[model samples]
Target: MELKSFKFDLDERQVKWIFSPLRDKIQVIELLMKIIKIILVDDKLDSERIKGKVVLRVSKMSRLFFFSEDKFFSINFPFLVFHANKDLSFQSKNGNKVDNKVTSDVLGLLASEVLLSSDHVLEFADPVADIEDYNSGFWSLLKELLLFEDGYIRYDYDDKHVNGQRHPLNHLDIFYCSGSTFKIGLRQRITDNHLMDLLDLETDSHFLERL
Candidate 1:
């Protein structure tokens, strides 16, 4: 049986803030155990199950963020591919055998990429409730008139129109609901990058676009 491994170098600050808080230590060995438990089920492990491993090394430079109220930290980490074995496979939710060797690596890459891309946009708090309070009761009326999430404001768009003209059209444009408020147009052409860029601008843009 061939052995496969995934390895990445995390920032020291991230190791202290994010990984350390997840458990006691922030070393590669500690984080590896946490990651394994998160990605694999208990029954999937065996005594001689192809010797799989995921390793995270600590790099020199790192950035960390602390959310006091949230009681969590964010870290920026880098990855390096060590040994990528091609013989390993995993059973998917559909009972189909698929390649599993790259699963951990892919997840690590995605998390790193998201942190690198969205670090700027996550600095602010949600503005909907704040603005609603200042409007004295206009927002309260709109809350009763519009749909919302379980405890948040959300819009439910329906596509049922006999002539196909009454449907809520989604686009990539920004809609200014008020002087300081805006809504985002969601259409098929708009990409996640575009949305993130608009969000980073600190404008009150809400995504009303559907997939």
Candidate 2:
């Protein structure tokens, strides 16, 4: 029997509701891609991004979060952040010491049970520069996700190279990753004392009292 194609208005609420039966198997992937696509264009506008953080705030918990970026890739995970240099675009961050990924699936890593626990607190100060683990060879597939840029985002799932190996790390198939990527950077972590005041990151006291 031929089935009619259900129209989607680019609404997630609709997608979740319409596909509830098959959600568990696909929703996580879809949700993950949704967030990724948003982060590519404008992370702040993505509700999933806000929702994930809200989950953190409401839990009254402090969780560790960090991110990494390079010419070939970008990655971040729950608190344990590492980065490779643009010049050394082929090297995996700390491939010898540790694999900082928290989970196997991109979706699971971003919004995982760890967040459910209220005992988390942001740890370390500029860790990538001084932490041993951050410098160690990358390990742990749980939090691992290949950074994709432009429309050619794709993973082979078969091309995962050994840590510290010189090769193109393109195991993630973005064509099937269900989304596209944009230029990602480490702009979110900038914390210069001189720069902080100029950013005006928080609302004044009057705004706080109202909330």
Candidate 3:
């Protein structure tokens, strides 16, 4: 997907707002599910369980949303990834986990390998891990959205570790190359509306058209 195909033009300020974390865990989860439903419905994809296939599942034990089985999405995006720095113990419906020292697991959306031909490609398994925890043992199949120059999109909520001016509490990174980074500092927290708008921009204003 090329950036030219996008319907909305994103300014610097808007980008910052869209990527920051403005809501609590429950609110974030609600927003994510809402967007996922929109995407699946818009593409006419099936999320229902069929032949023992599970598309979406919410784990109360871990306080996370994920899919237990593969082939969930019609597209190559097999997993959805979202992460928060809040502690699992403190996370609840009433209030958010606001402590910066607490380490929490990532709620993620991951990508699968899209084979271009009949050739066999390496297979990868999805696992729940912390941020920056990549295993070098297996080749990663986690490539999420937009084939724009072989680039994928990622959102981060980093309030746990803020070292002076080095790391911003909330920021967005849009990059296509390893060892290269293009970060945008978010002045305000990101809301569900911003996320939906972001998707609309990438999906050629489908959400807006529906409205």
Candidates' C-alpha lDDT:
0.30, 0.26, 0.30
Q: Rank order by TM-score, top first? A: 3, 2, 1
In model 3, what is the error at residue 127, expressed in angstroms? 26
Poorest lDDT segment (10 consecutive residues) of candidate 3: 67-76
Model 2, range 1-211, lDDT digits (tens) per residue? 2211111122444333322222132343333344333322322334442211211100111111111111111111122222234111111233432211322233433454453343644321222223325433222322233331212221121233423223333232222232332221121233222121222224232121221
| TM-score pick, better of 1 and 2 | 2
lDDT of 1 by residue, 22-124 (tens): 3211232234323433333323344344232223222232112222211222222222222224222233222322223333322343245443355564421
The candidate that achieves the highest TM-score relative to the unseen native structure: 3
lDDT of 1 at 200: 34
User: Residue by residue across 69-143, what tens digits does model 3's lDDT show?
Assistant: 110111112232223442112222323231222112222232222322225433222242323254331122212
Best by lDDT: 3
The stretch of ten residues in a row with the least summed lDDT in candidate 2 is 54-63
**Worst 10 contiguous positions by lDDT, candidate 1:** 147-156
Off by over 4 Å in 2: 1-30, 43-139, 143-211
- What's the count of clashing pairs in each model shown? 1, 29, 9
Total backbone collisions, model 1: 1
